[model samples]
Target: MAARRHTTTRRPVLAAAAAFLLPPNPVAAAERLAFDDLYSGWSVMGASFSPRLLALVGQEAALRGYMAPPLKAEADFFVLAREPMALCPFCSSDADWPVDIVVVYLRRQAQPTDPGTRIEVVGRVETGSWTDPDSGFVSQIRLRDARFRPL
Candidate 1:
């Protein structure tokens, strides 16, 4: 008896269906950002936003950093710093702010992770200086509607 090759259109259909069933890849979907990548240079005025960072402005991006302790146990936002900071920068003067820090505004209020804990945050990037109306916090950069997970 002669053997015949087996093929079916159902394979493609099933694969398409499976793709929809699978959860989206967060890492793949977001542009990875870094503290060192945030700036191009600094003048007497302040740090300049790097071309890479500016390009990500108004777009969804991700960055890994240490979470600074938030003012409240649970809040809608927190600060992410290159290195773990013990004190709340928000509670102090602007002079105390870390060089590599950016505000992360969460999508919802949740318990803040321990200070210095490394985590990856994903959100829409915003550039230029902006102040939080509710908290009276000023930030050069921010990640809006962000969510984070431990790295």
Candidate 2:
């Protein structure tokens, strides 16, 4: 008669166990925000940004929206809107820019999706009025170093 013993590797087991000890970051990952959550209220003049939205500035966040038509088929930036729009949000004028729209500046040029295609974007949230130097596009809210995928 004979007896056999089995052995298991410790490295993998130790690595898996170590992961549990690490603290989780509340904002380590992008937080999902809704179009409706962008503003606090509306008026003939304009809407105000909600405290929650303003508080997210400089933090990574995600937004789901439809891509507005871009100035070029492949461009470094585009506008995202709550609903599909026939024209770029900044095409008309700054005053006409919708509160529900957010300018998305990509890490690199990207082929914008069709106007009707829904997409989700992740990037650093930026708030405050700023104008693009090249296109002369004006925006109050923006997502910088962003990436998007079809929804």
TM-score on alpha carbons, each prediction: 0.76, 0.73
Q: Where's the lowest-lDDT run of ten residues in candidate 1?
A: 1-10
Which lDDT value does model 2 have at 41? 92
Q: Which runs in model 2 stand beyond 4 Å of their true positions?
A: 1-28, 87-97
| Candidate 1: residue 33 lDDT (0-100) | 72
CA RMSD of each candidate after superposition: 11.3, 13.7
lDDT of 1: 0.79
Return the TM-score for candidate 1, rounded to 2 decimals. 0.76
Cα lDDT tens digits for candidate 2, 94-128: 45655678999997788878889998888899998
State the RMSD for candidate 1: 11.3
